[model samples]
Target: MTEPADIPSPERVLDAGALRALAHPLRVRMYDILSQFGPQTASSLAQLTGESSGATSYHLRALAKHDLIREVAGRGSARERWWERPRGSVSFTNPAVMKTPSGRAATQVIMSEFLNRRHQQLMRYVGDSIKTPEDLYDAAAVISSTTIRVTEEQARELAEQLTKVLSDASDRFRDQEGEGVVPFSLRVDLFPLPPESN
Candidate 1:
C-alpha cells in the first residue's frame, strides 16, 4: 500500500537486521526519548540513561546503520552529533519478519519491553496524578476496560476505529513548535483475555 504524505505512517515492517539492531532495551529507550523530545545528542541520552556517552554513541550508530534512526544534519560539532528517528514510531507488522525464528523472538522481546515500559509510565502517572493540577487530573485520567463476547470481525473493527481516532488526534498535535505543550503517551492494547475459568 502507498503511504500518504500528511499523516504519520504506519510502522515499517522490520527486517531481521533492523529488528536485531533495535532489540536492545537501552537503544529502545534512546528511541523513545528522541520520539518525545525531537533531536538529541548521544551525551544527553547517555546522561538520561546513565550510560557513558561512548556507549550511547555506539548504540546510536547501530540504530542509524539499520535506518531506524538517523543523524540530524548540521546540528552539532565534531565531538557531538544529534540523532532522531525519521518516523516517530515503528511496528513489526510484516508477516515475513515473524516467519523467521530469530525475527519472531526479537519482535516479541521488543514488543514486551514496550508494553512493560508503558505500564511503568502509567504507574508513575498514577502516583503523581494526585499532585498534578486538578484540571489535568480530571481531564487527562482514564483507565477502564471491560469484557464482552465479540466475533473476530467485530473486534478488528473496534480496534481499527480506536486507532483511527488516536491517529487523528496525534496528527492534529504532532511536531508542535509552540510552548506550554507537554509530550504525552497513548497506549491502546486490545486482545482477547484468557478464558474466565483459566
Candidate 2:
C-alpha cells in the first residue's frame, strides 16, 4: 500500500528518450491499468485490454525501460511474470527534456494517450452511474471560482496547502481493505493568468 503523505513531486522532467519510450497508447493503457490493479502478468493485461500477448509484452518492456513499470517476482513454467507502476501518482515540470523535434513529438503523443485513457475511464463511470443518487455512488462535484488579490508568494503557499490536503486524503484511503464500494478521484488544478493578462 502507498502512503498519501509520502507522495513526491517529480524532481526532474523526463528526458526525451524516456518520454519516447512511453509515447504509445497501449503503453499508457497498460500503466493506468497496472497502477489501479496492482501487479499483473502480460497475458492477463493482454486479456483485459484486448491486445495480443506479444504487443503487451513489448509495451511493458518499454515502460520498464523508462522506470515506469517493473517485473515482480513469480514462479516458472506455470509461473507468470507480473508488472506494476512505480508510484501512485506522478507530476512533472512543464518543459520536459526534449532535445529534438522527434523527442517533443514523442512526449506529446504519450501525454495525449494518457489523457485520453483517463477521459474514457471517467466517461464510462459517469455513464454507468450518473443516474444513481450521490449516497449510492459516492460522487460529488463542486464548481467555484475565486477572485483573489495575492502576490506570487501567496499563490505558491496556497498551492502547497492544496497539495497537502490532497495528500492527507489519499493517505486516509491507502489502507482501505474492501470495506466499501466507493471509487473516487481527488483532482485539483491551479493556474495563473497568462503573462499578457497578468
Candidate 3:
C-alpha cells in the first residue's frame, strides 16, 4: 500500500486523443484493476478479469500506448512482464472536453463505463448483505462525512485531508502481510456548483 504522492493542481482540460484512447470498456476496466492491484502480468490480469488472455494482452498494450499504464521491470522473468497505473487518479474539465464531437463521445464512453462498474459493485454489495437493522448499522459505522462551502483553495485543502486519511489507513494494514483482511475501496468526490443547480 504505497501512499499517493502530493495532489497536483487540477488540469483545466485533458486532450481529446488521450481520452479517446481510454474510451473502451476493456481499457477502463484494465486501468481500474491495475490501479487497485498494483503491478501484474497480463496472464494474471486475464485470470482475475475472466477475459481471454489474448484480449487482455491486447488491451494492456492499448492502455500502454496512451500512457495510462506502463510496464515495470520484473525480476528476471522474460515471459512475464508487469504493468502499473501511471497516476493515482485522473480528472478533467467536462465542459472543456465536450466541445468537440469526438471528445464528447470519448468523455461519455469513459464516464459511462466507470460509473456502470461502480453501480454494479454497489448493487452486488447490497444484494449480498444481510437486511437486518444491526447489519445495516454495522455498515453505516464504517462511513464518515463532512460538508463545507469553500473557495478553490479550501477545496484543495479538503482533497488533501481526504487523501491523507485514506493513505494513513492504508499504511496501518500494509505491513500485516497475509492477514486476510477484506480489501475495501475508498471513494472521494468533490463538486462545487451553485445552489440552484442542486
TM-score each candidate: 0.87, 0.71, 0.68
- Model 1 misplaced regions, further than 4 Å: 1-10, 131-139, 196-198
Please provide, for model 1 over 41-71, each residue's C-alpha lDDT reduced to its tens digit, 9 standing for 90 to 100: 9889988889999999999999999988888
Candidate 3, TM-score vs. the true structure?
0.68
User: For model 3, how does the per-residue alpha-carbon lDDT over 12-96 read when each residue is reduced to its tens digit?
Assistant: 2456767887889888888777766667778988998899888888988887887777888443276777888754346633676
Comparing 1 with 3 on TM-score, the higher-scoring candidate is 1
Q: Which portions of model 3 miss their true places by more than 4 Å?
A: 1-14, 92-96, 131-182, 189-198
TM-score of 2: 0.71
Task: Give the clashing pairs for model 2.
Answer: none
TM-score, cand. 1: 0.87
Task: Please name the candidate that would achieve the greatest TM-score relative to the true structure.
Answer: 1
Candidate 3's displacement at residue 116, Å, is 1.1
Query: Cα miss at 21, model 2 (Å)?
Result: 0.5
RMSD (CA, Å), each prediction = 3.2, 4.4, 5.1
Over the stretch 95-183, how does candidate 2's per-residue lDDT look in tens digits? 64555678768877877887777778767766666666564346564435676778999989999999888867655664356766354
Among all windows of 10 consecutive residues in model 2, the one with the lowest summed lDDT is 1-10
